[model samples]
Target chain A: MKKQQSRPNILVVNDDGITAPGIKNLIEVVQEIGNVVVVAPDGPQSGMGHAITIGKPLRFDRVDLYPGVEMYKCSGTPVDCVKLAVNKIFKGKKPDLCVSGVNHGLNNSINVIYSGTMSAAVEGAIEGIPSIGFSLDDFSQEADFGHCKKFIKAISLQVLEHGLPPATLLNVNFPKGDNLKGIKICRQANAKWAEEFDERKDPYERPYYWLTGVFQNNDKGEDTDVWALENDFVSVVPVQFDLTAHHAIPVLNTWTFDV
Target chain B: MKKQQSRPNILVVNDDGITAPGIKNLIEVVQEIGNVVVVAPDGPQSGMGHAITIGKPLRFDRVDLYPGVEMYKCSGTPVDCVKLAVNKIFKGKKPDLCVSGVNHGLNNSINVIYSGTMSAAVEGAIEGIPSIGFSLDDFSQEADFGHCKKFIKAISLQVLEHGLPPATLLNVNFPKGDNLKGIKICRQANAKWAEEFDERKDPYERPYYWLTGVFQNNDKGEDTDVWALENDFVSVVPVQFDLTAHHAIPVLNTWTFDV
Candidate 1:
């Protein structure tokens, strides 16, 4: 028998469950590049942050969602799906790269803190694997991802060729389908949500609340993810799991304590 | 007439509920330092992970808990408590410092990802204030915060004098009531939870799961928070909210595609 070439195993995951059009599009893109496997949540889990299902036994089903590409539907958080796929499902065989999202909306700025899409990517980084989270600035179910396919292929190939720095992953957000600008490697902008809760009465006259927020970016800097997305560019921000503020350690050491 | 001196205002909050003994002990220690104002969750909201109550109406109660201190119990997450305290409740007056936890257990290593206690402190830092989250390794209602009081007071007074760096907070973890070996200013080690979900049956025979995990430390460096805690010393790690991985930007910039 002739020696066979080894193909890179790519694990595709997303926060918007297994059946979302976002992941379906992502799967099609991955199939053109490498041997792909998808293990994602069964339902939408947006704003889940880096939360893992510790208080629940996760159930996973080997579903035939993406034909030819092995897929599993997991009943857990996005982080859980990544953990199960890496540890239990793959066992000792590590995937060459992990890609999450093509998320329905942008996970830019501080929104990444509460994002299931980004959390799946962050989990991959924590496990020392090269990973990327993709999101569109548009949140519509019918949003066009036609413009993002080429950029996704380029980024995925780069990651596969040159493995990412340990403890780092990419947060790639596409500008709302518009005329081409370009991709900008940027930093997370100084931004936050100005909360507005919508309260309405149910049929039984019981009040319910819906979370709403307006993005507030006071920073006028041009090198931020917010600025890039605003200029119709794909923002590629390298994100890490370590939260340490290395610059503050010296300042903390100077305070006088009675003890 | 002589003007009366206002006591140093200390805002006390935690991931554990307002009624937990941990906060009670925290209030007592803070009372000795200055005036205390507590705004914490009405019930236990551990593992909330910086989640704000954006989709709901918040209600608060001014309760008689700490005799001389003003306290409010809020129907929200820990991050919500900090927000309400800063924007709505305190109005124009900013506190000298915000303190979260004296939490029932450890927030060392990667546990800080899902920590509501640290999230409250991080929120405070975002608001341009010095903040700190203190946790003991013990997870008991009556876990001894006694031995850690001196260290806590020492650190708090230090932060009060020398403010933290912009967008940074301290994650301080004390080993559960043992003879202290002083303090260690350490970096957060690379560690993670080896999660094992325990499946159980409810009285109604429905299966439910509880989150359980064992802390696994792969890093053996002496300069780590894990090493400090293992050596019976209090570990202080300066944590930041900026999730961007700056080092990976150069690598991402090399990626190319036809735009």
Candidate 2:
């Protein structure tokens, strides 16, 4: 008989703080596959893309939030939680996998650029761990995540079995509602937020501005994340952190810079 | 007679706070090209990648920092400065170009993923403005920037004349010495910071940690940004915010995920 392999060690993190129901549901699903460790932000960290706490001191303490799982609440951003887990908690022993979110809202298309949920997975990829970030299309305090449990387990198990490519992570977005189609491998849609500042007076009558934006999708490609999500399919865009635009190098080299 | 073209409006921003000498030198060089508007963070915001202010209200006010230049100091991240400039100052009219950071330190290779300097430029590109972020290999309060002035002007003028490719910006890094080679268009190096947290105690004897890391570059390709910078060439890596790893999708599609 073949020797049974040891269980994989999985690091769980999120942007929606430790108490959010989304992460709790994720923990329940993943714990069946491996030994899970939870290290997440203490407060809501929506849109805090790739941010690390540099100017301030960081604090993380062990918590009993989930049954039969080791968990900690971090007083920092989502990226900081990953850093802390890697450097302090794990003590330089890299985990078998790092998974972030089952985030409360959508992280589709251009939203990935501004997402703390996706940034945690990006950080994990940078750390040489097979990683994935999961998000739902709904934005509610009590968002329904029932449709995501089986899908999340399947994806996580596949990553554990197959492993991911270097410098890459999966940005997975699930469509809202229970009647879901299968997953679609897609690219990031060329989309953006058209920002408008609602200038208002504070209690002391000083003028302040609250940022509000409308999601604008201009890319009409059928193989985009936005299109897949709109058609009720789970969209998975493989994300890499290397920002180099390789196609533009030849054009840039032709320009003269002699002064 | 030829019709006279109006002066281009340029937006200048940085992560090194409003009074940093790096930005001051940049302003002096770019002012000769067009009408200048500066909106930058009031404090240092290094390693703050693509972060936006959503929890608290933001405050910004006009300041007289440079002669013949309009300036504003914002109480937010580098990305916030760009958004405020676009919505509040420019009033939805896109500037001719946006330039961020003649930075005090280098944003080569993996540093670009965590850099507030490059994040500002990325924010600009997302807003459909041609953008460039410049950095020096040296990290000092009074680093010599005389050698960068002419080069900065040349690059900025080129971007203004011929705008960048769709959804792209430049990550330009200069070598630390006066004996400089010409510019090299390169790709982002495959590199990362090996982090080590220094555990220490506070005044009350509670333990806290400070993040410190050594940059590890294993990529040996001469066409990479790290190689170009190490060889004393000004490296320009055209960067895009779309994190999609298009090459990895085919492999992922073969994996089984049926639950």
Candidate 3:
């Protein structure tokens, strides 16, 4: 009798829906390393952050998209997709690893807080699984993802071999260029989007606003993700879901709160 | 000639919708200290992390709910409420302080990542405003909030007097009790929701799932938000929008990624 070996099960998720080229490219790369199980949003969920659908009922449908891989399209946020996979699909059995995105746009610096792609990976980390979120610095639907496969595979393999630290996941951003520099492990830059709303009138002449913003980098730190991305390097930021400002705790403790 | 002293402008937001008792209580307290401008979701936006409305058009209607306060009900997430208030409602003039919720439920520990209430404050912090998010441990719509006003006012006044550290906001979770202990400035407890899906059949005979979870606190640290909340103390956690796990960067740098 021949001994059978089981492949590692990998849960792949993205914010750019199930049919997006970014996730398709991600699936193609990760499929080589494990048994891929994709549970992603049914539609574009960009800027959705870590939202989970509570007020509305969630529906998921199995689709035959990839050969030899199980795929489910979820009518919920990226975080909800992870929950559905862990609880309903996998029946509480944690996967070997979770990978989110090859996101349509960058989730670097301040964008990490507003990224549905990174949020999926963060959700995976919260569920006690090593996770990585990949993104390219391109927003176009026709953006090329050819250069991202090697980096994605390298990072995925690394996370699989050595699990990420507790409560932490990687936010990997690929610079959009032909001659790509190597990966750089860096911290999130102190950067923000200067919001500018485009005010316009609806058919009823009521004013409506469209959210738009310009990325502004105020930090001059060379070891930051923004700096690495600008230098054509794949910036790998070890992102944590713990929002605690540990340093500020001591300062706040000093203040008397006698109302 | 007497110099006219202008009251500090405060932006109030919540995830429990504009008409929810939580925001109404929040507006009532903050109005005592500043010029209150309430821009909150029109409907419940619970579990809506740092989500923003990008794909869909956002509409906000000026509502006259609170006396001597400007209130707007926005058709977007809590984070969207912050953006709309900053860019459109206030017309780019940053408010002196941004406060979100007397949230119906606790946003302690890992809950902060999935909280629309905390996300609103995080958004405000990203936009360089001194911000704070308040939540009660109770989840009932008719939960008593009389015990939270003093702590809320104290924290709000503190943030207004001495601005928070750059890029940092406060996640304040109040214990649901009549005799509440003093505030404890603490870190986010290492905790997570152990997801349990309640599978059921819809009207069409297809299976649909409702997301339910158990709060699991594996961290035994006393200086944590969870510990503080459980001890009948108001947990004041200084939260930051920067997702970077700074401690893990050096460890990741040791790993070779020469693929």
Candidate 4:
């Protein structure tokens, strides 16, 4: 038998399937720090949101995608893949950490909700694991990942050294290819896409609509992730899954409802 | 002409179908409040999360389900329904208020992430409209909705009169049956479902698994939605869409990282 691999078990996952160059680069970086096990979708699941497949059966198959990384392509959402990785694939062996993405586009601000990449990281955090979701502002197949390796390694090492709080994960976004810059920890910018549906004609000459939009950032706060990324820095925001708006509860209680 | 049906423009939606008894009851109650416009899923989309279809073409058809309620079943997520309703159906005129679900079960605690019912309401809030997502703790088709009518009316009217703050909506979860003691404006409980998959054999002896889980509450605070619902009180949590952990930013900024 071959020598058993020994190192910290790092579960690697992404939304852009097992074949994306972004994930390939991510796996290569993760391999330096630990034994990487990739469990990703078989195809692109961009803008899938925090969806989980419940109506259908999920399947996982081992695939030889990354050269030395042990990888599996699963027929499920990003959240489902994390579940399968933790529950079935690594049943008895708990992973030291789970890292998702290095996604093609940004998951800053409200895009985090619609991001399958962040969902995987959030799922890992929910399972009480230290997790991080990384994204580049560039949305291209050939987007440069050279600048991200150092930062990724640094953050991963930090996460390993200092454990994350429960039910929380890091949402890390990098500026597209340019001269090197530093890193900044910031809050998720309060922003959204002002959607404008493009109405087009189909082959049958019927009107069809495509969901498209332009990102609009109304928040001008200097401490926001959007601002930080714009200022030539990698923005890291500690995202939590528990969306409790704790401050609003007291205000709501004062509302009179005498019925 | 049937007097042109001067009705009060109410938007009705749910995680369940347009034909579900929950929405039907909700529509009936709202019909007393406004002219109802029903836009919901074609089938049950429970635990669908906040998924919106970006890669597929959406199809919608008009159907006559509830008398005097103009209904349309859309092949899109709950958030998509709200979008389509705002863009296509009510292109020019805004509805009085968007109400989503007298849903089959509770969307308390961390269940809000996987809640399609709340997604619809969130979509409305994003569009600068007042919205509410109401759910009963009972997950049965025969769950009694008689007790919900009065409370629903009161809350909806209050929202109509005193408009909801921008980017915020109410997440109201009622206790099962008619013995609701009162209403409580509470925060979301620190709770999550511990997932357990049951592996079994299919007809051809093929292995398959079903997702199952138990709700685990780590918090016992009386000021929580879970606690209020458990004690026969309706829980109303004012929900906001901004996912930024603003408080953690300063703390994260203190961490040392190189360029």
lDDT of each: 0.83, 0.91, 0.90, 0.84
lDDT of 2 by residue, B1-259 (tens): 9998888899999999999998999899889889999999999998899989887878888999777789999998999999999999998889999999899999999889789999999999999999999999878997999988888999998998889988899999999888888888999999998887777899999888788889999999999999998898899999998889999999988987875
TM-score of 2: 0.98
TM-score of chain A of each: 0.95, 0.98, 0.97, 0.95
DockQ of each: 0.47, 0.80, 0.81, 0.54
Q: Sort all candidates by DockQ, best to worst.
A: 3, 2, 4, 1
State the lDDT at B99 in candidate 3: 94
Runs of candidate 1 with Cα error greater than 4 angstroms are A1-5, A196-211, B1-5, B53-69, B91-94, B197-212, B257-259
- Minimum summed lDDT over a 10-residue window in model 1 chain B is located at B50-59
- Which residue runs of candidate 4 sit more than 4 Å off their true CA positions? A1-6, A201-207, B1-8, B202-206
Q: How would you encode candidate 3's per-residue C-alpha lDDT over B53-118 as one tens digit per residue?
A: 898788888999866788899999998899888987788889999999989999999999899999
Q: Which candidate is the best by DockQ?
A: 3
Q: Quality of candidate 1's docking, in CAPRI categories? A: acceptable
Q: Could you tell me how far off, in angstroms, the CA of residue A75 lies in candidate 4 after the best superposition?
A: 1.2
- Candidate 3 residues lying further than 4 Å off, grouped into runs, are A1-6, B1-5
Q: Which candidate is the best by TM-score?
A: 2
Ranking by lDDT: 2, 3, 4, 1
* Residue pairs in candidate 3 whose N, alpha carbon or C atoms collide under 3 angstroms: none
Poorest 10 consecutive residues of model 4 chain B by lDDT? B250-259
**Fnat for each predicted structure, in order:** 0.51, 0.79, 0.89, 0.51
lDDT of 1 by residue, A209-254 (tens): 4556578898788989999999988898999888988787777677
Give the best candidate by lDDT. 2
